[model samples]
Target: MYTKPPIRKIIHVDMDAFYASVEQLDNPNLKGKPIAVGGDGKRGVISAASYEARTFGVKSAMAGNLAVKLCPELVFVKPRFERYHEISKQIRAIFHDYTDLVEPLSLDEAYLDVTENKKGNPSASLIAKEIRARILNEIGLTASAGISINKFIAKIASDYNKPNGQKTVNPEEVISFLETLDIRKFYGVGKVTTEKMYQKGIFTGLDLKQKSLEYLDTHFGKSGRYFYYIVRGIHNSPVTPNRQRKSLAAERTFSENLSSEIFMLQKLDHIAEEVSNRLKKSKISGKTITLKIKYSDFTLHTRSKTLTYFINDKALILDTAKDLLYQESLNNSVRLLGISLSNLNTEAKKNTAGLSLNKKVSVQLKFDF
Candidate 1:
């Protein structure tokens, strides 16, 4: 009989209160004070809240008004995306130093598969310790790490020790540790699902793992399969690298609404020109031109037209947007109008490819991408 080894080592690293913590770290005067990163108005929502704000029930996505009501003295600050991204790059570099199997969940958290790490150390606990230490020493931040056999249990264990903490769960420890976990603490189980689990008498992991696949599927649909395996501390998802961007869009809110078609046409032309410049810069092209409009009463509409081939020319882009806008039945004063392009084409047509030298030069000018 062949017996399998009982322990597999995985690590989950999560930065502490990421955005607001960065803001506080850069500014000493803001230390120990409740902080939120977002707009400070009735229409705004808290993007991130520091631990201090969380102590008063302030949380991310809470309306700014409600967040303030909970913590009257909370300080609001705008998000610094560029700086945060730079810091994120720094931390990811540290991850790559150990293992290439790093799956970033967000700017603040990632899962690292260290079964065969670059450090050649058998103990994942020590690797996690060094990684956390390096992040603090190099980035002036605190992070928590959890080590287990797979992503499922590793993620759960990471949160077990937070705010400059780390924990490890061996294979034997997985079943026993998970048996007592709150149903709400399970990853991918959000509020509604949590309620449903409670209703099904699945208050803990033992209750979850005990259910048959057919029974769980009958109750929870497709996600039931995922829950079934997570309860058993089995996760098959691998660390995927960053995905290429398929499309990009830009929009704006006007200072005041304008009803004039001529004004909207002018705005669309400028937007098209900007998109053309970007297309040239990125060496990309799209066949689809989409026109979007928002009315003063908050109603919205969009129209799109896809050409036979991609184009990066400014005139072609503006003409397509203009045609789409003319087709729409506008009944109200438009507050904002925007244009976007998608469905990229990266090659010239077959006939155009074998064109004469002068024709080739002309086509290249008309289609810079």
Candidate 2:
């Protein structure tokens, strides 16, 4: 069998518990302690939980109730969208300094294809190190990185070394790595699917690779072809610059000074949903979603959240906006409600393109966030 040419140099960078980390970095008192970012409400979900909290079983998207139950001493703070957006901007600047091919998955993670990087450095490992150092020295935040040939491999590698760690998957090791990797660890695989796969005796990439393409097609449908290809370390996804913005939306001007927190939240949610629907229509997902709010006294604030994954769904974008708004204890009246989704999907970002063409694609959301 002929091995493919030397693999490309791809890097996936993810910031750990982004919102919680930024909060900790801003205030020294919060460092080294378990912290969670989100509202302490009945409906509030944990937006981000620090690594320390995670050790105690806390996780993002868990209910605020469950998170506190997991770690009784977990400190909860409201998200500061403006502050998070500032840090996100600083981090993206660092990425751009390295290469323009940076495709941000969200504010906390991005994929960088450095096969022919501008730094003229052939080794992607060095670049990842330099980038991490800069983020540490400047932003005072830690990031984990995965370096490999393609998005699938790099994503897996990045998670291998977590919490200020880095992992590099060399081309030669791809086969062995996939062979032993747990099927549950696959990028798009989730709990339900993993259990189902286990029932089928497909525990790892080796098992997946050994299956017939037709079998995978008849069973998992189109995703089967993708799994088969990725197991062999074949992925043609490209790094896309988040240049083309799909839509822009701003909130209407309010005549009255509103002091009700619920009212402001309701308004913001409405604006967010409208913008989100537009994104879905364009067949695009965005990393950045900006929320604009104007206080009664004309104090305007815009809070933007960049994500680790591309957000194409309306519910997620609106939820993020709602989370950001919940943090602002709106004692003052608001005048504006605006939200916009930017950094639409790049060429490689459009995973749905081929899936759209594939008649066998499943309608269910099989993967976990």
Candidate 3:
């Protein structure tokens, strides 16, 4: 006799308009009003928009000016990361009470694997409900949760019910659920990819599933292979716990756009110093350095170079960033400068031995403007 594979239980918990909700919770006066958490300055980016604000077409990451135009009565509040971190800890602790296999996606979202939970609860749906309740009762904030056989379905389900609701997708319903999901709703499918999929006559998961693996691989490359499997509900990527940071970065937006090379270099130096200091504190080095530039018009560009050896020195980071900056002519006045280090060497001591011996080597900067 042949046996079927056991279904895994996964839950994705996401806080609802986390920052905006927190602002309302802390200040009762802000409740039931259109509020946005972020700066309201000229270069300010909306971090989170309340449901009320969303009604007025306000959204996070939208320019402050544009958001204001969308909602004239919008209230902007500066973000309090320290407070958010504290709340995240409290939420994570609650997740630990049910299972240790918790993978945090951000301060407001996490994936929990409870195939064999500590509570001995067989129903992942009940567990998700309880977790959402605990967050509301204890943290005084609302959270939404999704329960399914795997992370992919659970993550998408979590968004189905908004603002203090939960949804569960049983194993039997996975196929139908995926079939009806829009292609844009698929993970990692952005505007460009969505347009490409439309051009290929793939507008939904069902359409995507119709393509052969060879055809998808040829057109979408690595991502094509991912789409092929995901549409068929074949995602087996485990919910990773304690995911390592692939990069550490620091960035700053200036009050005024800087056009002079001297002024731009000065900002790059500070940004590089900040990134190097962070790498030092983390006790890591990286081979790849990325320079992020945001133009005055809010267009973004990045230039990256992978070095021959890992480095975490302030002077080296500054020099590398300066060189990358000079390699490209400014298409527009720069308003923000940032430096990031990736391909991290976690074993800092191993790389330190050859740190002094490592020489400066140039790699062509890859541009994404």
Q: Write the per-residue lDDT of candidate 2 for residues 163-282, one digit (tens) a residue.
A: 899998777677788889989899999998898899999998899988877788888987888886677777777787764555456465444556777777667767767776766676
Q: Write the per-residue lDDT of candidate 1 for residues 1-369, one digit (tens) a residue.
A: 222223346789999999998999999888899999984844355789999999999999776777888888989998898989989999999999999988888899998878788999878889999999999999999999998887777888888877799988876676778788888899899999999998999999999978977799899998987787667665555555552334545454455577888888878878888889888898888888888888877778989898998888999998998889889669898866887888765433323112121221110111100
The alpha-carbon root-mean-square deviation between model 3 and the true structure, to one decimal in Å, is 10.1
The best candidate in terms of lDDT: 3
Per-model TM-score, in order, reads 0.70, 0.70, 0.90
- Collision count for each candidate, in order: 0, 7, 0
| Candidate 1 TM-score to native | 0.70
Worst 10 residues of 3 by lDDT: 360-369
- Encode model 3's per-residue lDDT on 1-62: one tens digit a residue: 22222367889999999999989999999999999888574677789999999999999878
RMSD of 1: 13.4
Comparing 2 with 3 on TM-score, the higher-scoring candidate is: 3
Candidate 2 minimal-lDDT segment of 10 residues:
360-369
- C-alpha lDDT values of all predictions: 0.79, 0.78, 0.84
As a TM-score, model 2 comes out at 0.70
State candidate 3's TM-score. Answer: 0.90
